[model samples]
Target: MTHAQTQESNHLQRGLKVEQKKILDTLLQSVYRQEGWVFFVYGSGGIGKTYLWRALISKLRSENHIVLAVASSGIASLLLPGGRTTHSRFKIPFALNEYSCCNIDQGSDLAHLIEKASLIIWDEAPTAHRHAFEAVDRTFRDIMQLRHPTSMEKVFGGKVVVLGGDFGQILPVVKKVGRADVIDASISKSLTIWPHCTVFKLETNMRLLQRDGKLPAIAKEGEDEPMWINIPDDLLIKAREDSIDEMVESVYLDLLQEYTNPTYLQQRAILTSKYDMVDKINDHILKMIPGGEKVYKRADRVCPITKTGVNVEALCPTEFLNTLQLPGIPNRELKLKVGCP
Candidate 1:
């Protein structure tokens, strides 16, 4: 059986969801069957690219066809699942220089191995260099020693390459590939005679929820559609206020019985003016509250300490303490000695 057949078989056994099954069926029937075809699956993040890729690989492997899956990010994770980097899988050199050629070295086992491979699935293809892809294609043609039209006629020569990525995230670090970058480049425009590639956009976002209990509306096919949601400023401000109020109430309740002093209550009230102020005051309160004790003592437990020479000592065993430093005061030190060490 071919690798595609094997993958489909496995997917059937696993019993994927309706949407997932639809995606798989579309890929198998529409994309994989085509030779010399470049299938691009563009979707939002967390919409299940990795899951689909695994299913595809499983089906392809079951068909007894070679499947090479490569990822741009999470190299270790990909390797754990038995995949390789696109560059390594294609046997393309890292540095592109004047001397660099598309032809793979003769007698190289790696080149021969890939030449016999059935399919190559490149994840995060948005980050892949156009030159790198071209080089790989050239190398494949060279390895087989077949001329154009004839050499590219066979399945491997006519190999199916599936490119998957979310274009919304990061683009290629070395060379950009996608609609915007290609359209911007004059050279890319000149080289294109006929559009041979079939671009498929994944419309349904399986990640976020919409206001109407449906999936977030994503542009199935268009350049002008907005990818991100535009939240209103008023709504955002209201959410912030609500969240702050809840946090302040929770903290106040936790410290209610402990710090009974009116001054402490005033300080806590002042700290709630902003989130940053709350954090600063909380840190201060935590420091004042002795470790291992949930409650904080009243300020009456604190005893004023006067620093004498370099040595300073506590006069009373106070449970609560707050250190204060004042300028122009004798010894310039004011320590609220506490009972707890």
Candidate 2:
């Protein structure tokens, strides 16, 4: 571990939450007993999921147990100690189906790693396809042959696997698929995986608690309904002719507030469901940046390479690719720079 990594682990060691400690204790028990236990920790944003993961890793590593840390995104992976993307580590197939297994060669280094690993911690599991989880489980069952022949009957070859993520956020991406298909891709909906797994809920927003130091107490079960965070009534927008306009004004009271305090720009953002709306709002805001200009221009192309014996370029042309207006990807043009448009 690097100096920074050690510092981070040490930091997380202090001020642990009650729920976080409960999860850790259960995991530590599983690691000690060498039993097969699958856990899914469900929590929304600002619930201290990453904090718990870091502290878990720090504790597990100190005891000399091999832990495979993986995430759905690169940014999320960086938060853990020696974390890698699930697809890269597990060799999950690109075009996943219900019946798919990881491309892990028997007796390979990856297989060896899985065999030696005491636990597997998968973060942002909700954002990945259920098939990805199935693939890893299949691969583990195949590559890892424990003491008994029926060891394969155990989940993940008798290894403790913990998956953590928020279900409310963006789910598994199903390109050109319907809403039903997208929901089907989610791990929660998987009958094969979800049924056997034990789920633990973390409802307390630790981030909010850390900031405010207080939260509304929930009534006892069967006594009353659960407590929910109260949204400020002033922030709500009614269905009016100028609702959209009113929303924008309400969100940004001083439209050009960042003009004087340039650093404030980093703290604010505009979110929209559509790409066009994002682009329009961004351009509109950039235009206000005191003579802000789109001075940079660069041509983008999707040049394919030869894979195996086939030429990838023959299947798709660069011109046709340039016409695509895909989500999150700009169409055939490199736009914007830091503090510029």
Best lDDT among the predictions, by candidate number: 2
Task: Kindly provide the TM-score of model 1 when superposed on the true structure, using C-alpha atoms.
Answer: 0.51
**lDDT tens readout by residue for model 1, 1-341:** 76656656675547555666676776666435645655667777766666777777677667666767777656523632477776555656777542344545755876666656666777786665555555566566566554345654432356667777766666555354765764433212322211444556665555543432233545545557846555645334343543644545544665635465665465444335454464455555556555454443334343244454332225544322233323432221222324322
TM-score of each: 0.51, 0.64
Error of 1 at 52 (Å): 1.0
Which residue runs does candidate 2 get wrong by more than 4 Å? 1-11, 146-148, 210-341
Model 1 residue 216 CA deviation (Å) reads 12
Taking every candidate in turn, the Cα RMSD to the unseen true structure, in Å, is 15.0, 10.4
Clash totals for all candidate models? 16, 0
